[model samples]
Target chain A: MTLTEKVLARASGKAHVQPGDNVWVNVDVLMTHDVCGPGTIGVFKREFGQHAKVWDQSKVVIIPDHYIFTADSMSNRNVDILRSFVHEQKLPYFYDVIDDPTGEWKFDASKGQLERQYGSNYTGVCHTTLPWKGHTRPGEILFGTDSHTCMAGAFNQFATGIGNTDAGFILGTGKLLIKVPETMRFFLEGALPLGVMAKDVILHVIGEIGFDGATYRAMQWEGPGVYSLSMDDRMTIANMAIEAGGKNGIFPCDQKTLDYVNERVAENGTKSEFEPVEIDAAQVFSYDKVFDLSKLEPTVACHPDPGNRKLAKELEHIHLDRAYIGSCTGGKTSDFLAFAEVVRGKTVKIDTVGVPATTKVVRELKEILWGGQSVWQILQSAGVQLTENASCAACLGGPVDTFGRLNKPMKCISATNRNFPGRMGNKESEVFLASPYTVAASALTGRITDPRTFMS
Target chain B: MAHTVTSPVYVVRDNIDTDQIIPAQYLTLVPTIAEEYVKLGSYALIGLPDALYPKRFISEGDISTPYKIVIAGRNFGCGSSREHAPIALGAAGVEAVVADGFARIFFRNCVATGEVYPYDSPVRLCDVLHTGDVATLDFDVDTLTVGGTVYSLKPLGEVRPVIDAGGIFNFARQSGMIAGEAPSH
Candidate 1:
């Protein structure tokens, strides 16, 4: 059996399973955010009675990462509902936004104290924070309310998203009936060219396979190139699996996964006893199909469809009015490092926006120096509009009043996932999905230019 | 438990995501309120395609418009697991959807909510069915008649009961999966 089958079988307490076979699997974790959590709670109450409690409080994680900082009353009300639900249930894993109560700036650098006491309870971009906070583990079955919950599959887990009603049922039953998805393996065998990142590789794959090419299948990455990718890069690939109609995208666990999890756990001042999941050598040949990504180039998904990809060098004539470099798919630390490499010492010619995935990433950015100044300061000086709060702002093409919303029709090159119509803002606006390197390069050149031209 | 209907087929291309079905901007409406849902449903498929399709499911300046069936290409609902997509369509009077394929989550949502009958076509239904073409769908016989041709639809299998009971919650309650009077709320 494939890795996905093995994991699902183990979770379901079955010795074997096949594609299209439905089984009730035990859920290790269930996550929801402000946008869907309130609806899930409503469904839970309506179906299971008002006084019903979740099956397990510790296994549930709730975060209000979307629409938190917006002035929309409905968005704020959703967060309030989640807060009251957390209070009523006494849930331990709720990550709420922290506000400086005293509003005083007293710096004690020697004591490692900053001016404002921004509490550490918040978890920005739940997909990125899940692994940072030690919620994702190999061989586990995790579920979230967001489509990109498949991002957790980078840790070699079977993770996917469900609708509010299914989530409510899971909340009450602690289990889900899922059909085992067949695995489609992609053997990445060559080294990516300089300035080409995992985002480009995935976009190339999506281009080869249209949006519905891998419907109801698990996309498994393997071989030398897959092993060579950083966890951030792997997460970027897994996060956009749904864009290609994949059930999930997974990379088998290796030393890199273990090392990253260990470092994150240590940074949190905790000792983790989590062990890496072992795979059978004979199970490697069980993939239903395989694709090769040896000759891939820096690619970009053009307006309206993520599968409508072209080589970055082929689309240099397309001018960009805005460049955004942030999201669960592109807002990691390594993504920023790549962005800085291309944007260093260059002024942006277009409206650029940069947002770190998490608060921890923000703290790390403050300590890094770029051109004799903090990386954050350098980006700001380069005319990149950095939002203060970390949330899913404008990624979903929210209402007109949303921050970073496309007020007028303009072409944009974004590092985020999905380029569906009206995805980033105005319905007439065109969005090109690319890597941070490509986005940064395009921002400097005001067009979709390949990063290799700008790289040192 | 099953019924047949004939209506004019509204053709849409592939990958009609939930975001396009009902943008996240209108997701705040309470799901239990019919008027709120009807108001939110008015904007279904708004700003999606330029021409060759009806931009809005609910007619402008009028709340009631007859639209019973939608025929689409492959992967009819491919992004996001928002039930609001089906809710908006159902409220807009879309009774059934026929496509070459569907995203698993959306297909399940169709069965769980009983809001729309999701049928799979062997061939690209969008290619065979055209806008304003009268199509007949028989759930009992699992066949679709469009453009003077009869096509067999993939059987619903175990999903039929969920739709027959008018939703998953109703099926679960009636089947004794849960013990209690179904909560009215």
Candidate 2:
């Protein structure tokens, strides 16, 4: 059996399981954010009775990330609904956005967007916060309301996204009925060349297989290249498993995984014991593919769809009006480090925006130095407009005033995931999705660019 | 579960993602709320680019759509796991969607929520149908008729009973997977 099969089998208390076996698996952690939390809570109340409590408060995590920074009343009301639900159920894992005594959603537009944070209780994107807050564990079944919840699979777990209805059922039952997906093995070997990142690799894979390539299957990354990537890089790759219609994307847990999980868990003061599962020797993969990471160049997913693949160098003629670096996929410390390396001491030709994925990442940007200057200072000097608060600002194109959102029909090069039409605000606007290096280079030139021009 | 749905069809190209089905900016409207559910339907498919799609799926200031079926190319309802995609369509009175393929999560949401019937056509239906064309879907034989041409649809198989019973919760109750009766939405 593959690692996914083993993890599901153990979670279901079964001695053995196969690809197509439908079983009821115990859920270790269930997450919902502001977008889906209120709806899920409503379904829970309607189906389980208005007075019913959640099955287990400790295992339920609620993060208010999307649309939190906006002033939209409906968005604010949604967060309040989550707050009341958390208070009612005594759920301890809620990261709230409103800290006023009245519990009213408030934002100070007078302050810089970065300084407009409500309080420290607020985290940013849920996918990044899951690992940062130590909610992700190996061999655990993590279900979230957001599609990007598959990002947690990088921690060597069975993680997938479900809609509010399924989440509502899990809230009352602590169990989910799921079928064991067949595994599609991706054997990545060789080291990635400089200027190419995990985003490029996944974009390449998605392009090769098309968007629905791995539908109804688990994508398992293996070989030496998978081990060589940092935990952040692994997270970036695993975050986009759904782009290729994958049920989940998993990697074999090693010392790096153990070390990162242990550090975060210790810092969080949450005690969790989980067994790491490995692919059985007799395991058979339904599909197998390999990528030679060393030969990869900076890649991009052109506008309209993520699978519309193109090399960054091949699209230098595509002019852009703006550049953005933020989201659960690209707004990490590692991604910023890569971006700063290219944009350091250089001015941007286009309007460039930088948003950290979390409040912790916000601090890291101010503390982490490059060439005697902090990343924050370097980015500021390079003319990148950095937001003060760490939230998913404009990544999903929240409200009209959302920072960095494209309100007009203009072209942009972004480090975020998904280039679907209207994904970043305006329907007619085009987005070129690329790595931080590529985005940084493009910000400098005002056109799609290859990072190698700025590197070495 | 024998029924027939006849209505005007809205045609779209391949990869009609969830963002196009329901944009992220309007996601704040929770579908469980009675009024917001209708409000969500008002904005269904509003994300389609004006140049590509000249016709709107749901007209301005209207809560429900005139079209009951949506014909699409490959990979319909892709991107994002927002159940709002299916909910928005269902709230807009979309009874069925026929496409060459579907994204995994969106299709699951359609069945789990009992919002709409997701049907797969052996051929690309979008190529054969137009936005204003009339289409009739017969649930009994799993066939869609458009302009006197009949096309066979992939059977719902194991999931038919669930949709017939109005979603997973009710199906689970009937199948003994859980206790209690289905709630009235």
Candidate 3:
């Protein structure tokens, strides 16, 4: 059996489980954010009862991230609704944006786009926060309202997104009926080249097999190349599993996963008892596909869809008006380090935006130095508009006032995930999805340039 | 439980992600709110580029659409786990969606909410049928008739009971998984 099967089998309280079997599994965590938290809470109340309580307060995690920095009233109201729900249920894991219990929390735009909302319980994106807050554990089943919840599978756990109805049911029962998915084995061979990133690796796989390639299937990455990657790299790859319509993307839980999970769990004082799933000696991968990491170059997913793959050199002629580096997929310390490596002493030709995924990452930007300067200072020196407040600014194109949002029909090379029409803002705008290396390289020039140009 | 739907179809291309179904800017309107639920329908498929898709899924100044069914190519309702996608379609009175294939989350959301009957068709209905074509979906015989041509649809099979019971909550109540909860409207 694969790692997914083993994890699900344990969660479902079965000795052995196979693909295509329908089982009800106990949920360790159910996450929701501002975008879907209000809806999920409403469903939970309607189905369970007007005054009903959630099954487990500690098991439910609410993060108010999306649309938080916008001046939009409705977005603020949604966060308020989540706040009310958290207070009503006394849910302990909520990361509140405002101190006030009422719905009067407003985005003070006069303070500037990146300022304000300082030093609150606000943790940026939910996917990134899940790991940092130690909500992610091996051999646990986590269901979140947001699709990128699959990002937690980097811890070798079974995590996927569910709709509000399913989430609501879980709120009452703490159990969800789910069908076990078949696993698609992806073996990454050879060490990753200097210019290449996990974004390129996943883009190549998604391009080889269309956007719907892993639909209803689990993508499990293995081989020696898996160990070569850092936890952040694995998170970046696992985050975009949904781009290929994958149920989840998983990696082997090695020392890196253990060390990261242990530190976070200890720091956050979360439940530390978790049994990690291991592969048996007789285990076999039914469907195997290998990707040569060394053979890869800086790749990009062109406009309209993430499956439209092309090498960076092939698209160097494509002019770009903006370069954005942020989101759960690309807005990490590692990704920023990659960007800083390319654009250390150089200036950006086009408008570039940098948003850290979490407050922890925000500190890392100020602390981690490149050459002699901090990453934040280096990016600011390079004329990148860096946001002080860490949140999903324009990765999904929130409100009109969202920072880094492509409001016009401009061409943008982004380090974010999806390039679906209207994904990052205007439907007419063309977004080229690439890694931080490619985006940073493109920022130096007003065109999509190969990161290899700066690497060597 | 065998019902038939006869209505004009709204056509769309493949890879119709949730963002196109319902854009992120409007996601602030949670579908669980009845007032926002109706508003969500007003903007269904509003994210489709004006140049590529000239015909709007929901006409301007209207909350409910004239068309009752959607015809889409492969990989329909892709991207994001936004249940609002299917909810918006259902709110717009889209009774069913016939497509070549569906992304996993969207298809499951459609079934879980009982918002729309997501039918998998053997043939590419988007290519075969035109937008605004009058079509009839007969679940009794498991066939879709458009312009006098009949197309077979894959049976809902295991999920039939859930949709018939009007979503997972209702199905759970009927199966004694949980008691005292009213069915979804």
Over B82-169, each residue of candidate 3 has an lDDT whose tens digit, in order, gives 9999999999888889899999999999989998889998998888888889999997777999888899999989897788887998
lDDT of 1 by residue, A216-327 (tens): 8888887778888888889999998889888888888998998887777677643366544465675633344344455666799998788998999999999889999878
In candidate 3, position A236 carries an lDDT of: 89
- The weakest ten consecutive residues by lDDT in model 1 chain B span B49-58
> Which tens-of-lDDT digit does each residue in B1-185 have in candidate 2?
54999999999999999999999999999999999999999989999988999988888778889999999988888889999999999999999999998988999999899989999999888888899999899999999998899999999888788888888998888999888877787
Off by over 4 Å in 2: A100-102
Which residue pairs show backbone clashes in model 3? none
Candidate 2: Cα lDDT at A251 = 89
Span of 10 residues, lowest total lDDT, candidate 3 chain A: A278-287
After aligning candidate 1 to the native by TM-score, how far in Å is the CA of A105 from where it should be? 23
lDDT of 2 at A347: 100
Candidate 3 per-residue C-alpha lDDT over A1-456 given as tens digits, one digit per residue, 9 for 90 to 100: 898989888888999888899999999999999988899888888888889999988899999888988889999888889888888899899888876655466888888887657546778989999999989998889999989999999999999999988998899999998888889899989988889998899898899878998899999999889999989989988988889989998888899999999999999999898988876665555468888899998999999899999999999889999999999989988899899889999999999999999888888889986677888999999999999878888999889899999899999999999999999999999999999999999999989999999877
lDDT of each: 0.80, 0.90, 0.89
DockQ of each: 0.58, 0.86, 0.85
